[model samples]
Target chain A: MHRNPSRPLSPHLTIWKWGPHMLVSILHRVTGVGVGIAGAAALVWWLLAASEGATAYATFLEWATWEWALLIWIPLSWGLIQHTLSGLRHMVMDIGAGYELSTNKTWANITVVASVLLTVLLWLYIFYGRG
Target chain B: MSMEIPLGRVRGLGAAGEGAEHWWQERLTSIAAFLLLVWLAVSLLRLPGLDHRTVASWLADPFAAVPMLLFVGVAFWHLKLGLQVVVEDYVHDDGSKLFWILLINFASILGAAFALFAVLKIAFAGSAE
Candidate 1:
């Protein structure tokens, strides 16, 4: 693959014009990494805390609900939703449908918008509906 | 070295027959993870409280415990597959790329194991006596 030393890299990101598809593609990777690293760590912590007892669980709850932690948790939740939606889109594309230019663009837009909307609704339910 | 044929050159390097299997497995796990996450969100919402005992007991239910364990396994597997791609794309160095791939695999396995153990502990230990 690297036989030609002078050939530019396949994905010359800076040279290619950006579009909705590109945005979604990039977000997919970003969110995947985010969930892989921080999200996984958070899950492990939550599990350990839960198993440890009431005191540990309470401590985790307090810290997780704190304002500062919300910064990370909110974005992580959004990323999780966004990645899931985008994954669904890719799954559809994998099956050889939605290849038309307009349809692809439309799906890309839907993936982003729907992800944000769903995330907001989830948080709303958590805060208000649960209470 | 002897000259290689054009078809052989086109075939290129890396694991040849395994790409399709890896791709299918990744997709399968993604689908499973998506459904499991939805179940988790709904379960969390229905919980009477987020306190230790309530959450632990909820997890202890066989219905919840089994799926949660499956979720951890599938989700971490998906994570490894996704991160492997990212590392391969951005990390141009061969050694660094291999290292990152191994690290991602190990981390995913360890993280998933820890989560599974915690859930099982709660399911059997009865949550802090």
Candidate 2:
């Protein structure tokens, strides 16, 4: 009810010193938006193509298996992993467990590293194990 | 003198009473997405091939189809909530913020519907053509 027109807008990103926490926060948003658009589109396409019949499915496979598609798929997978991990970290914080500065930084770093590792492991499994 | 009535002040006890529900839903959906994604990753990894018949048959299983639908729905809902926060935070103009939020909601619904429809079609019609 009390509107303060002069209230400073939050999270002036430029003014704040960069840290692991900031990186994680920014990437969380970036990957979130990225996956929401590109990832969701890919998912819908895959489902629709699969349901449509063989020809559509074959066409989708062609695109999905293309060398160029890996470029998108890899990053998309990474984004998915990173965003999920970060979301978990956020949930933990929401439960009031990780407010300590050191704990927060540690989790942020862990999220980044683990996402990359998991993404690589996924690709490795797809290429080698599946074959 | 302050013009607000005592009842009005007590009615809304905190900053936007709606925040807790939004916050809780985001967390709940995130947890659901976390589990569903693990299932998805492992399932996709184990798939012998990506051919239409193979993938369709895999999706045709009740275990796969049900969870896939749930994943699509929860993931899109979670996505919409997350993006809404981003838009609310960054987009300065009220008109643009509202537009982006509505667009996000609509797009998420469409995406989820398309996904569920596709899954249901495969589940019921059987991928054979």
Candidate 3:
């Protein structure tokens, strides 16, 4: 596979001076892909639990309680949070809210901060509060 | 009343109304998704090492089953819309962009449909022999 030297490469994330809208936009794509993978994993677990009988079900159980599940869920929760918040931002833009640069930055900050806060709260509920 | 503007003069490659359509559907879906996520988080946390029967029973509830399906469908559709824009923005080739946009929508639809069908069948199916 010969690399095409003539074709210009896209700008790298690190090189760009990040703005709020740009940051949120990048995070949205990242989280969307992450959530898609998580969705697939959930689907697999669901199908296995449904069709396979008690033994396979127990296998899922083992995985669900392990640290691995926490590892997965924390990021997945954050991903979902980010995706949802960013999605709301897009929806607001569609309706013409936050079209002003000031409002746009405010909402973008809200999206990122809210997603992080939600993720922390989720973890607290799952670990400290529940168990 | 003043004479209406001429169609040709006014139209200017008129909008497909995608803005309103996507905006409305996305908002509706986001609301559905938020509610569903609450249930989902609680339900998953509440699961005490679910045996097959317990898992099946929870999903069998019409309230849970229906919303779960709707959430997945809406979530995927919203995802497709968002990703389509990203792909369109970044992918410079017109043919490639069109191909990807179509592919993304098709894949999400199929995925959402399959998941919905599977869940519904399990939810409503006659008792397993």
Top TM-score prediction, candidate number: 1
Model 2: TM-score, first chain = 0.87
| TM-score of every model versus the real structure | 0.88, 0.87, 0.71
Position A65, candidate 2: lDDT: 93
Locate the minimum summed-lDDT window of 10 residues in model 3 chain A: A44-53
Tell me the spans in candidate 3 whose CA falls farther than 4 Å from its real position.
A1-16, A63-66, A100-102, B1-24, B45-51, B125-129
lDDT of 1 by residue, A1-131 (tens): 54787876777756877889989999999999998899989999999999888889889999998989979988999999899999999999999998899999999999999989988998898889876
DockQ of each: 0.81, 0.74, 0.26
Q: What is the lDDT of residue B23 in candidate 2?
A: 69
Please list the C-alpha lDDT of all candidates, in the order they appear: 0.87, 0.88, 0.73
Cα error, candidate 3, residue A78 (Å): 0.2
lDDT per residue for candidate 2 within B1-129, as digits (tens), equals 879898865663432234556767888898898899899988886788778888899888899999999999998998888888788778878788779889998998998899999999999986465
> Please, what are the lDDT tens digits per residue for candidate 1 over residues B9-108?
6563433223556678889999999999999888888888788888888888889899999999998999988888777778888788789989989988
The alpha-carbon deviation from the true structure for residue A30 of candidate 1, after best TM-score superposition, in angstroms, is 0.6
Question: Between which residue pairs do clashes occur in model 2?
Answer: none
Candidate 2: which stretches are off by over 4 Å? A1-16, B1-18
Give the Cα error of residue B23 in candidate 3, in Å: 5.4
